[model samples]
Target: MQRTPEPELMDAPEQASAYAAADFSAGDQALIERIQALFPSGLGPRVLDLGCGPGNISFRLARADSAAEVIGLDGAPAMLQLAQQSLEKEPALAKRLSFVCLCLPSLALPKGCSGLVSNSLLHHLHDPLVLWQAIAQAAAPGARVYVKDLRRPPSPEVAEQLRQRYLADAPAVLQHDYLASLHAAFTAAEVEQQLHRCGLDQLQVAEVDDRYLEIWGQLP
Candidate 1:
């Protein structure tokens, strides 16, 4: 499937709410586990979660390391609002985790981060280089980076097939978004080219699952 760009931010309340309500436990948990493995111990004392919609992975990162402070950055105010509400529910997490409303490629990071992670965010970008540039700017020396996103299927028929197989039970809105995302997603080879173009060839890009691709490694 050729790349089709979606909105860069999930700023609409209805869209954000539907996405927040969607059940992504299996994949989310798998991503958390992989990130944990990257550090073995933890992601150091500070972490940055780019495009952290509703703070799912940010909270997990905080929990993975009791001492780590996590900053969840997103361009969507509605999504950040949901994340803040979630933070309020977990008083302990509130201290170690916080959400910031910031768009990517700005290069004005909240702080020099020790680690960075992003989930399902790359496909939304109109220009892939924005993400790579942000990553290079935000990361500290030797910061661990992990990014996971849907891999564009070989054809639209395959995308629809995967959607029916995996998200058949989801709400119509969620299902629509999933299909759009799949169409917008990059193939593993495309991601490799993006990484190389961004001068981040050291990062490893691999197809981690039938529908997902992962890029992970440390900053040079």
Candidate 2:
């Protein structure tokens, strides 16, 4: 299926609310576990969570390592608001975790990041290269990189089947966004090409499970 790009940011009040309300603990926890397993040594002392919608993984990343400082960046203020609200409830994470309102292709991207992880941000970008370049601009020597996002199915029918199988009971807005994201997602081959263009040969891209692709490695 040809990729149909969705809006880059989930900034709408209703849309952000639905995402905040959803119980995605299982998938979020799985991602944290994957990161820990892949980089068992640690994510270094500082980490950046790109496109951190509501601080879901950001909180976990900060909690996973007491010494690690985590920064969650998102383009959407609505989502950031939710993240801030959640942050207020956890005073312990106040000093270690914080959210920033920022988007890709920006010169203000924090430089020399020890680690960078993004979840579901690639598919939304109009130019996929923006992400790869951002990774290069922000990462320090030997920075760890991990990115995971939905993978476009071979056909729209398959996309719908996966959506129904996993998100059948989700809210209408969530369902709409999920399907749109799937349609906008890139395949593993396309991601490999993007990496090649960015000279990011060190990072490895592979299909994970039924409908997702993950890229991970230590930056050279």
Candidate 3:
């Protein structure tokens, strides 16, 4: 499937609400586990989450380490609003978790972040080099970076099959978004080329699941 760019931000109120309400616990937990495994001991004190959506991964990261502070950055205000509301429910995590409204490739992040992670953000980018360049410039030396995103299937028929197989029971909005995302996503080889072009060749790009590709490694 040829890549088709979706809107850069999911800023609509209804869209954000539907996204936040969607149940992604299984995939989110898997991403959290992968991030934890990246560091044998634990994540560093400061972490950055790009395209954080409603803070699912950000909250998980903070919960995994009491000492860690997570900054969740997203381009969507509605999504950030939802994230902020969730923070009220967890007063303990409130102090450790923060959300910023900023679009990627034109990011302004605090320096020296020891860890960075992004989930399902790549396919939304029309030029993925923006993400790779931002990661290189923002990450601290030897920062652990873990990014996971959907992989484009060989054909639209395959994409539809995967969607029916995995997301058949999901909400209509969620199913629509998943199908659009799959069409927009990049193949593993394409992502590897993007990494190489951005001097991020050290990162390991691999297909970790039937529908996802993960890129992880320490920044040079």
Candidate 2: which stretches are off by over 4 Å?
none
**Residue lDDT tens for model 3, 1-220:** 6888888788888788888888888978988887777777775889989899999999899998899989999988999999999999899888889999888767476568888898989999888998888788778888999999999999999999999998899878788888999999999999999998988999999997689999999876
TM-score of 3: 0.96
Error of 2 at 88 (Å): 1.0
By lDDT: ranked, best first = 2, 1, 3
lDDT: worst 10-residue window of model 3: 103-112
40-108 per-residue lDDT for model 1 (tens digits): 866677899999999888888888788889999999999999999999999988888999898877857
TM-score-superior candidate, 2 or 3: 2
Report the number of clashing residue pairs per model. 0, 0, 0
Residue 149 deviation, candidate 1, in Å? 0.3
Give the alpha carbon lDDT tens digit for every residue of 45-134 in model 2.
Answer: 889999999999999999999999999999999999999999999999999999999988999998889999999999999999999999
User: Cα lDDT of model 1 overall?
Assistant: 0.88
Error of 2 at 204 (Å): 0.5
- Tell me how far the alpha carbon of residue 22 in candidate 2 is from the true structure, in angstroms, after superposition: 0.3
lDDT of each: 0.88, 0.95, 0.88
Q: What is the lDDT of candidate 2?
A: 0.95
